[model samples]
Target chain A: MTPPEPVETRTTTPAAGRSAQTATLAEIAREAGVSAPTVSKVLNGRADVAPATRSRVEELLRAHGYRRRRAEASRSPLIDLVFHELESAWALEVIRGVENVARGAGLSVVLSESAGRLTPGRTWADQVAARRPHGVILVLSGLDESQRALLTSRSIPFVVMDPAGDPGVDVPSIGATNWQGGLAATRHLIELGHTRIGAITGPSRMMCSRARVDGYRAALETAGLPVDPALIATGDFHHEAGYRQGLELLRRPDRPTAVFALNDLQALGLYEAARELGLRIPEDLSVVGFDDLPVARWVGPPLTSVRQPLTEMAEAAARLVLDLGREEAPVATRVELATSLVVRSSTAPPPA
Target chain B: MTPPEPVETRTTTPAAGRSAQTATLAEIAREAGVSAPTVSKVLNGRADVAPATRSRVEELLRAHGYRRRRAEASRSPLIDLVFHELESAWALEVIRGVENVARGAGLSVVLSESAGRLTPGRTWADQVAARRPHGVILVLSGLDESQRALLTSRSIPFVVMDPAGDPGVDVPSIGATNWQGGLAATRHLIELGHTRIGAITGPSRMMCSRARVDGYRAALETAGLPVDPALIATGDFHHEAGYRQGLELLRRPDRPTAVFALNDLQALGLYEAARELGLRIPEDLSVVGFDDLPVARWVGPPLTSVRQPLTEMAEAAARLVLDLGREEAPVATRVELATSLVVRSSTAPPPA
Candidate 1:
């Protein structure tokens, strides 16, 4: 590994020390025996500076290293990072991952939430466009047709993470294999001798939620187990929604012996519901979750979850967006990351 | 109670549906009988466009209800959010808090890391200044004089979070009362009838670690107990570090019956170390933690911890930075938020 480079501090530079208390344009003009506006024009690099005056000012700037600071400020680079929302802890890791890559690339990442006040209107687009970012990385939860159209219309090179649509408009995308992860989770429960398995999934409209639901169904069919519609419930991917669905599922006289939640937040809700219903995990009912976030290992009975390579995913997403900015032609690419099941204490054989 | 806002969507208006697909700049230009560049310039509000051309384009835009996709890219309304490092799930909540306030103010946040390639330099400052952000929020573990000088030289308004200096600096700051929280945690252990207490603290260089250590010392003195330097061990605020410290402390011949970890991550490490030592929480040893992160509740024995309002701190930081941007003069503001101790299963009396 390369040795960590030293951080450059402005104070250490000799030039900064000389101009530590440098005067303004008026002061410079007075010292140069010229008008303030003339000094301003010369400083701003505009034309019409007399040779004698320009030479004198140039000499002064060289003496003070004043021109170096102005030149440095003028050549600043811009980087923009877009997110669907910053409401969850998961986004934090993603932000860190992007920051790491951006910093490594010697770029500054401008953070924007597409779902925030700057909705896909001229106002929003204008505000973002004003930044003139070199590239943009969009962490989209889901984009409606208009938002997608608007983004495409701007012709800004962008990479999307967990995009809702096909991203056919030529933006690169990075996402986890939600369907396969879902299948593996459901299959794990089946292998553990669970016949009646239920699922609490996210909003069906989200591509990820739909993919997971599909995987759950496929697993049941592969095992020759009937896919019961009643056993499938939809949630907003929030703990409260999962808790509500969990309570409803447990209330059934013929309740499923196991449950697979699409996300850890939902799984936590299920745990709460299980506690309220006086049911013990694994012993009374087995539970599995996806997106084995940091809390998965800390949760009681350690949640058995499908771990998504979040850091890797974030790094890949950042790289994709940065690359997109550099490419002229629209590059439509999709990277599907693999997932693995972490078998913890949350899962066990069905109760006899 | 305020109703939750409706989620934004992008359905096209029925009247503009067909036109949106077929309409192009060429078509608009043809309709107005102007050249493509002229039409573009007029639409973009370039001063170079003749008044007549501008008027015509304005009329056509309103008449056709034309929705231009993205605006012409420029530079404005940018802000950089800098973090020292990213390691925990709790950082997500803080990011969300910042995003929330930033979005509301129509300012885009740029994410950057302090220790990476984008460290304080002409390059980093250039990158940030290129986008021309209104202000910046630096989320540092601590700030040395050199780092402070860098921001001052850049002439950018910034608000520091969890900083290590006197808030007498020219910038605003927001931080949790780590010292008070530490006091609360230690006092709780004292109230629980524990005479012998130990501590696992984070790196002493951090303001939080130092503050917490001070609080612990104050509590011990208040309880008329001699402060035992041997009973305290330093960790890197990570689980493994905490675990190692826990093992060392527990293995000591004069091991204290209770341990106060400066943060939840350390407490978790201590928990694991205790388990490895075949000791049950609150029975063999009681442990208290600071920063009652979400994982604190999920641990096997729910952690008794001091809760820092992370989200609130993040919001305040955002607000402070934005406020700084709007002001012409430098303002030094310091905000100290309070913390509370939550009693959970992890704490009890000393063993007989």
Candidate 2:
């Protein structure tokens, strides 16, 4: 575990230190002009309560920084796993990891998709509250303020795996060393005698994506090579994007002899682009990919890629969330598993 | 929807027709020499019940063909999705389909893996009984008699998707037309003027695998070509199996010019084998696959494949199980969705 980098607010302590942690449900109910049972009903996410009353209770709970005392029996023997979208093999790896931990803990996993929404909807939060799962693990997804407050008030723990965006300083998360992976990938190509190397990047909003591109830049700078803006292409981390971007890069009169794709799918797409253009891999064009997905190995000529420990990262996130639910004291707030480069036939010395 | 197929025992009727459906928990308690509350606890999967007493109650419940009365409020807002093993992109497609229906129904999906067992463990059954999901969707997995009885006694309906084995006449299942897909794939190769063709078979015990191989034989026999047993190889529907089995077939003195690999993974494995043997796809050897996974399009030379509609079948299975839980009348006992062939660049006329 990495040393804890202090998050601004790890517990239900009042912003001004007014001992809000001591507030009781009955006290909050009185403050909200509702009965104790009504407050409890709102806490349980029952729909019978009036919206106004529920809002009042929620506001008071937040203002007081109220945290429900843990009652193990009240929580279902389940853990919740939410995803930004369930689209790729990348997601399956994470799901298997969390499922592994959940099975070992005698808990089933409740899966949900935000359907491309970065924040899971209000309905999803309500469902989580009603179910009272041991904890929630979100992959490449984040919680909005209200959603975070709701989980906090219910004492339901959550951890983010590879946050797509900045998850805020207070959020606990698990991630791979994307920057390091990118650096190693670029260095490998550089070592193979390629100077005019093109790069394809994932969406800029993602921290991991940004970090990797930055690493690429760092590698070029450290090796006294010029970084050309014209050689870089942006993609959405999908195969189609890779193909479209790869074609744009390759059709250029000054096309580089090598390219680094942000992920395995993109690399495969690049392979397709190269094939369509009558280019031979490692002979006319060199390529490197990230994620080292299973397909990377099965592709023609095989792919050289940076391996992110997706399953391990997911297992760590699951364990951290569960531990957060049980431990009175805070555990590690953020952890990054190491990423390594796997060299294969996809890369070779540039053609003379 | 497909026409209704008769299932011998679709409901809770005693073998001797002694009106077991009318047997109450109180009567079951009396028969098992346990209190009514004890029987209720057993039905709820409480851990506190004595093992001997629980077994006695379970035996009585089965002997009487007991089925619990439905109580909507008692059912959790979850649907269980159990897999024979969560090993491939195929599972992700199914998960997305079930998640789509579950979200629309305002429910979440609880996922479990039988960990390669055809039958899920006893603990999984107990957990399902305890959580009481809206329904259970078992992918390539089945329930034993006692496990089925346990779910029946708890009023939890289940549907199988692409059952690996015969899921019994009484079990509701959803599947694709695997045999037809195999026939179409083989016929396409035959039309390309290939006199000799090779076939890769998945495990024989799985009905889907058996149907596929049978379809291959049908295609060859119908085309008036002598079927060569040596050209047919056995694989386990995995990349490694395809590679190993493919090597043996390709190394023969008179190897077939074209091969139908049972699934996409195996086809990719075959691709690797061809590459290793200095063979060019569509030129040296033609290949076709089943399950048309996304990788089919991205692999070099784009694999020709049979599309199984995995997600659609999963959605249908989910909808069917939910319908079974609500409808008083029996719905379709089994349904087979259609499969089609997607010919890509992997297949071509044999060498001139």
Best by TM-score: 2
Query: Which portions of model 2 show Cα errors greater than 4 Å?
Result: A1-20, A328-331, B1-20, B328-331
Give each model a TM-score: 0.73, 0.94
Query: Model 2, A191-309: lDDT tens per residue?
Result: 99999999999999899999999999999999999999999999989999999999999999999999999899899999999999999998999999999888889999899999999
lDDT per residue (tens digit) for residues A179-208 in model 1: 999999999999999999999988765788
Task: Predict model 1's lDDT versus the native.
Answer: 0.70
Clash pairs detected, candidate 2: none
Write candidate 2's Cα lDDT for B1-352 as tens digits.
0001111112343424245465677788898888887888788777779999999999988887788766566677899999988877888999999998999899999999999899999999999988889999999889998899999888899999998999877788999998998899999999999979998898887889999988888999999998999898989888998898889888888988999999998999999999999999999999999999999999999999999999899989989988888854455869999999999999999998
Candidate 1, B96-196: lDDT as tens digits: 77878977876677776666322345455445533445667767543444444333322346787877444454457898998999899999999989878
What local lDDT does model 2 show for residue B64? 77
- The true-versus-predicted C-alpha distance at residue A286 of model 1, in Å, is 2.3
Interface RMSD of each: 14.8, 13.7
Model 1 bad stretches (over 4 Å): A1-76, A115-122, A142-154, A165-171, A328-332, B1-75, B116-122, B141-150, B165-171, B251-255, B328-332
